[model samples]
Target: MPRGYGGTKGVRRPGVALALHFAFADLWHDRKLSVLGVILLAALLAPPVVLHTLQVGLVETWARDLAADLRNREVVIVGEHQVDADLLAALRAWPETGFAVPEPSFFVTTQTARLVGGRGSSVPLDMRTTSPGDPVLARADLPPPGQAGLILSARAAAELKADPGSEISILLQRTPTGGAVERREVILPVAGILPEAHWPGRTGFVSEGALLGFGDYLTFSSDTPDYRAPEDDERWQSLRIYAPEVSQAPALRDRLQNAGFETRLMTDQVDRILRLETGLRQLFGLVLSLSALAFVATTILIQWLSVLRKRRDFALMAVLGMSRRETATFPLVQGATMTAIAAALALGLAAAMGGSVEAMAQGYLAQPTEIVRPNLIPLLAGALGAVALGGLAGAVAVVRLGRLDVSRALRGD
Candidate 1:
């Protein structure tokens, strides 16, 4: 037995004991190989994992409700003032018939004083106080009309520091049935705030009838005040659309185009997101392919060399009356044991680094507020699989040891 060794000759066979000693010593003596395996594995796997997780989360959490809104988001062109029954039916019967409702067109925006009541003061804060790129939220989340309700985006609620039952006064840009942009304020109790989305802009909402005379608020209008040039001629600049699915996008666009209705894809819609997701997946595949090549090369070369270096030691085991199986087990055991330790270290490092990556991506990629969780299935499977595979591959070198001419080898040594 060697000095300071935990076990002695009487406790275990010399070959197995020696194999165990070498196994634990691999990391301490071969530190570079340990680090290389972990680095290559993490690089190969992280990006796609993070992206897939976030996308899955958004679809499940936020998009479940938003799907209906986007499906019905489309533009309707009517030269005359009224929406006919046939036109309404035609829009609904479109191939991707997600949303068939007609949005009333026309509205007005004006600089009006709003009494955002926590203190109930009528001192108006002009549009300047609104968050940049502020859009009016749909206050329609209430339990249908005739219910007292007001709506605010999560950002607006924070800006106004408002809560349920708080009163808010909103003034539209104009009244319905055509005319000059006018001012009319309506007071309604704040029913709830919209769910927090990653978009930083602010939003506010009032009930469908909260602002009397604004029929366009419930629908769309050709005369929406393009806040950019309020005094300019109300040109045919903006439109709304209700596309059902991606397959219908081209046909629907064509339908509107043939009728001289100018249409555009609202990438704010998920189709744009789907394209972005495709790009990310391709990038992930590229990264993994590169890293995997490096990992395979490094692992095979280093391990194959390690086995060759231990040939002399293995010959000594064969000289000691060890069977062929015992001889082969020497390096297989050592490689498997080393892999176990490396996997543990890699997993810990990945867990720590994954959170930082999610935080960086949240705002950059418009990801959900939560971090993408690591895929435990692949991680575990890979960890176990790699160790088993390396152990098996290393056996080729060990098997050669059993055929060594022990007496001559020992004498030569």
Candidate 2:
């Protein structure tokens, strides 16, 4: 027989399988502590997991919805004076610019046939001219460029009791040279109705030529000292400038401002909303990180207590001729096993909590909330964090076991 050390030679130092077997045996022996550890980990991990899931869903949905309306976010530029054709051309040529349309006449108060047709009520409207491919109009409903008609907003149509193919009369208040106010009435047909989704206000869209012709009528029809001929009016009232995307609005606004135009962007409201969300997420993340760090500390304390309680067993193993490496490795195995079990339980608990959060979000939002399923990033972070804490505890236990005096521990002193 070939004996290597103390007449027992066939076996070398204890390997990983032996360590793992002892680890599982220890877990079964101290099942109560194992269960308590897993419960603590689950409690600590669940809330942050739920919050992370909800935040991911909300931010993604907000960004996607905003992107869908990007085409409609036209930068409106009102000059210090009225905008002119040259400015409109320059804007259309601006970098990242899509379309630039002149809105010379706006907010012309008018009466509809339904209003004068025994309805006895008038509706003030926002009127603007649109051309083909105007971002404001639905592609299928856009009137041809020279069409002489108006497209009413859904609200306007409802109030006026009008529909497509119906006629409406607009009353223009004109002041003549003698300071006499005359009401100029014009009859026009409704081309289409603007969808409620696209209606920012009680607005209407008429073809550019049709609107210019109406302006001409207002200009020369009455001998008014204040009358400005539409053709001679080089200055534009304002411009509706479309950009390729909403993200480009800030740059486009700056460019226009530098070029001597006053501009307003639709993205200002969106940016404000996004900034609020970012701030909330940042605060939440800070709280979560601190909580996680505290949990790690608590885990280290629990591991230290467990190792202290097992000192007698470690000393007995050392006395039985187990090497210092084998004795130290036992607690390491126990830590890894316990941490793995706890991480699994915690993840399951987090998933259940996430479902509840999603249901609550859907009910409160009262709209489609696009929550991502099987979100792995946060879950992985939690698992990695727990394992790292366990690894640190294992290292500490190993070092403590290495320094233990086996004789003193085994002497019951």
Candidate whose TM-score is highest? 2
Q: Using alpha carbons, what is the TM-score of model 1? A: 0.57
TM-score of each: 0.57, 0.70
Give all candidates' CA lDDT scores: 0.50, 0.66
Residue pairs clashing in model 2 are 4-9, 83-236
Please give the lDDT score at residue 50 for candidate 2: 58
Worst 10 residues of 1 by lDDT: 127-136
Best by lDDT: 2
Model 2 Cα lDDT, one tens digit per residue, 1-413 = 87555764675555556666776788888888788876776666656665665666555445455545644357766643467767667778878687676765553323233434536467776777677678767444555434657788888888787888887777666666877777666666787887766665576777665555556556654332122324534566676777777656667777888877787776565565456567758966886897678667766776777767777887877666677776666776666666767777767766776667667556644256565554688678778877777767777877777777777778766
Q: Which residue segments of model 2 deviate by more than 4 Å?
A: 1-22, 28-32, 39-48, 59-81, 89-100, 107-124, 138-146, 159-192, 221-234, 241-269, 280-305, 317-333, 337-374, 381-385, 388-396
Model 1 Cα displacement at 38 (Å)?
A: 7.3
Query: Per-residue lDDT tens digits of candidate 1, residues 121-154?
Result: 3432222111111221332333321334545556
